[model samples]
Target: MSSQPETYEFQAESRQLLNLVVHSIYSNKDIFLRELISNASDALDKLRLESLLDSALDADTSDLHIALETDSEQRTLTVRDNGIGMSRDEVVQLIGTIAKSGTAEFARKLKEAREAQDAAASAELIGNFGVGFYSSFMVADKVSLVTRRAGEAEGTRWESSGEGTYTLAAVADAPQGTEVTLHLKPEDTEDHLYDYTAEHKLRAVVRQHSDFIPWPVRMETEKPKEGGEGGEGDEAGGTERVVETINSMKALWSRSADEITEDEYKEFYKHVSHDWTDPLETIHTRAEGTFEYQALLFIPSRAPLDLFQQGARRGVNLYVKRVFIMDDCESLLPDYLRFVKGVVDAQDLSLNVSRETLQQDRQIQLMHRRLVKKVLSSVKSMRTKDADKYRTFWGEFGRAVKEGLLSDYENREAILEVSSFPSTHDAEEQTGLRDYVSRMKEGQDAIYYLTGESRTRLENSPHMEAFREKGLEVLLLTDPVDEVWVEQVREFDGKPLQSIAKGQVDLDGEKDDEDDSAKDAKNAERAQREKDFGPLLGWLGTALAEDVKEVRLSSRLTTSPACIVGDADDVTPTLEKMYRAMGQELPRIKRILEINPDHPLVTALRASYEKDSGDAALTETAELLHGMALLAEGGELKDPARFTRVLAGRLAAGL
Candidate 1:
């Protein structure tokens, strides 16, 4: 192994993030101590768990704890933990590269939060990204770490000044765990970054943030001797260094809810989640029967910056009888509920159970089912009991929760009960499905909806014209996932989910309310129009056969002269495009083209064809009409140059 210290440049994104953190991100710099202590507690937890798994491990298991030491003279603070530390390679891989996967995205979100002047969101981003380690830069000018992994003889030391570079070197004789020493900056009372070296300040921070930590956080304080008397002039008779535990070490989840204050819960959430904002909601559930587990989960106030990023770390920590088993135990909850943060402690789980086994274990599955139901129920309660918080929750996590409709079959209906979408019924507020069903038209048998890139797009779509004319409500779904889940979820509350753009929609119910004579006249009018355009429709369909499956009269179009429609079972054009964008291979799918018989464009085209069916200009008009319909529905033309050329020729001839 190389004994010389090696200097490395920070990744570009990491360098940018470091500059932001050191200067702008944190308003309450006192939390820097909180972050370091949380990390120490985690290290102690890991050591305890590793000892349980590896009986022959060489490290000491007797005194596993975290220690905080301060040097007032040097303006420094050190957090020490006798736990599973890191090897030289692990240190290089973990700390040297700050968020390896989404550093750029993390930096972008941080920059946005700063620009928006949202300190809470900025704090949440740092916590959720597992870059809490870098927060030391907020209070310290220089930071150093020395660690020796359990059962390893050699250790590693990492040092950095948050100046776009860090150094790493091997140590022949390092302590059995990890120690992080922060060289604190000069005190700035105005900035609220007070003296971290003061025992009072360190103790207060630890009590607030890590009081419920599972491990004992120790600190040394000098006390006057019991028998010694204080000197009136300058010095005390005697003093002793007493090793004192700073935190309460009270397991918040194990205690009753009434015992813990709201502030305590909030602080604990920040500790576990690394989020600085108060949680949107807290869930506490204890299962007493065959598979016993105590769960304390929190729904975050803001979504993590990487919530949608692929391979983002998710799920909650797992503890077996209050012993840490793993961080992010995905087997405990479904992926759609990944934003939830907390701990689940099981009484009967084997401390040695592998992650693979946990996935297949019957007990874990029961816990998984129970935890998911509890989370959904809490959200449902939020939707009913508190309107403001529920809106905040949805704004942050609605897209993630909607994913459950695809994978969670058992909880599908439960998920739907809490889901909300924008609708034509109300422009300002979103409506739930049940409310939509209740406010539905008297004879409306199917729940109507239109999916597109945006609500503005969906509202203006030609497919929505007849529905709007008939005073029927149509749900507007704009999410990309909306394109998929609608296909999987056929109906909600017994009414089938019908897409207005997919199949032919009949809004003739208004005609049913008319008298018999009026109904007969409307029916006759429709039949006469169809008969007169029957030949023209056939010719246009044959002419545009390569582009459209059929061209016919449209009941869905009232103002628009022509529009595109898909078969009830055919894949949507938007969905087809999505698949193609994902590199999926798909066969060409043709859709129907519907023309409004009342529109002058169609009427004149019919008259011109009747006059001279063999006219070359008639074919150009047919192609132009088809192209216009495609553009109206936001579909791309197959041959843009040809369509533009034909359109220009027609315009020039008219001029």
Candidate 2:
């Protein structure tokens, strides 16, 4: 091993990042200690797991804890943990390289935040892109890390001054686990920077941030004298140094709701989630009988950046008998609930259980089922009890929750109960399914809805014409999942979910109060119109054979000349495109073209077709009508060029 430390320069962006961290990245300097302690706690957790996995591993397991040491004379504060430490390569890769990642983007965000004078925005960027270990620079002018991997004899020392360069070298007699020593900056109370070396300050920081950490956080303090006796030390009043655990180390989940404070819950949430903001809601539940487990889950106020990323970190941290078995145990919660962050400690599962075993374990499945139900129940309760919070929750995670309707059949109804969607009834507010059902028009047999790209498009759709005229509400489903879930979910509270764009919808069929003579006249008028339009319907059906399955007079269209409607069993156009986009090769689904007999365009086309059955222009007119109907319902035309050519020609001839 070399006696002299080797110097290496940081990546260009990393130097910039370090400058930002030391100067402007953090608004609260106290959190620097919280970050260091969090890193220490993680190391401790890893060491505990490592010792369990490898019994022959040469490491101390009896008293694994984190310690904080400070020296006023040396102007240094040290955070040390007797946990799974990093080797030289790990030190270079994790601390050296991680800071460099996304440096450009981080710099840009910091610049923008500074220009906007938004400290909160600058803080948010740090959470989005972690500045965990590097955050130490916020309170310290220089930082050094000395670590020896638990089973390895050799150790490494890394020191940096938050400048462009850092030095690394092999060290002898390094303690097991890692210790980060921060050379404290001069006290600047004007900038809210305090002396981190003070005992009361350290105690306050730990209690506020890491009080619920599973491992003990200890600090050395002056032991009080007995009967006014004096010790032979250089301290004030000749007091002796005694190590005391500063943090509670209390398992927050094990404590009952009444015993724990809201601030305590929020602190635990920040610890588990690494979120800067308070959680929207906290869910606490305990199972005492057959497979017992305690769950403390939190619904975040905002979604994480990785919420939708594939293979992103998900699921709750899993612990067995107060010992962490694994993190991001995907078996505990379904994919849709991936945003939930918390810990689930099982009382019966073995600590040595492998992750694969947990997947197939009956107890795990039971826990998953119970936890899912509890989360859904919590959301449902929030919807009724706290409307504003529920709206916020839905805004952040409603898209994810809608996914449950596609995969979770058992909880489909519960998901719907909590779900709300914008509807034609309201332009700005959304309506839940129960409320939608309650507001159903008298004698309306089915819950009507329209799935499309957006509310504006759905509202302007020709399919909505009749519903709009009759003052009937239609749910506007704009999510990609909406195209699917509406199909899987057949009904809500006994009303079948019927799409206005599919099959046929009769607004007047349930009018029981209509007199017999009026009913007879209306039915006779409908029959006569159908007979009058039969020739044109048949001719258009054959003319647009490749485009439409059938053509008929529409009862759904009131103001529009024509509109397209899928058969009851046919796939929706939006869903078909989604499937095709996913590399699914499906047979082309043909939709029905429904024309309004009262419209002048249809009446003129029928009269001209009767005048000259083989008119060439009439054939193009039929194609144009079919294309118009397809476009009216947001369907793509089979042949856009041909439709355009025919439309252009007709416009020229008319002029």
Best by TM-score: 2
Put down candidate 2 lDDT per residue, 64-155, tens digits, no spaces: 99999999999999999999999999999888764445678887887788778788777767766787677788888899999999999989
Tell me the number of clashing residue pairs for each predicted model.
0, 0
**Clashing residue pairs found in predicted model 2:** none
TM-score of 1: 0.93
| Residue 599, model 2, lDDT | 88
Q: Which residue runs does candidate 1 get wrong by more than 4 Å?
A: 1-16, 104-122, 163-165, 222-240, 510-521
Once model 2 is optimally superposed onto the true structure by TM-score, how far is the C-alpha of residue 487 displaced, in angstroms? 1.8
**TM-scores, each model vs. reference:** 0.93, 0.95
Highest-lDDT candidate: 1
For candidate 1, the lDDT comes to 0.88
For all candidates in order, the CA lDDT equals 0.88, 0.88
lDDT of 1 by residue, 1-655 (tens): 5378899999887899888777774687777778877887888888887888788988897988889989999999999998889998889898998977768878888899999988877877777677888889888899999999999999998999999999999998898989999999898887777889888888888887788988888999877767656555435548778999988888889999889899998998988888878988999889997678899999988898779988888999999888898998989999999999999999998989878798788889999999999999999999999989998888889999999999999999999999999999999888899999999877788899998888888888889888888898999998889999999999998999999988777778534467898878888988998899999999999999998888889998889999999999888888998999999989999999999998999999999999999999999998899888888877899899999999999999999
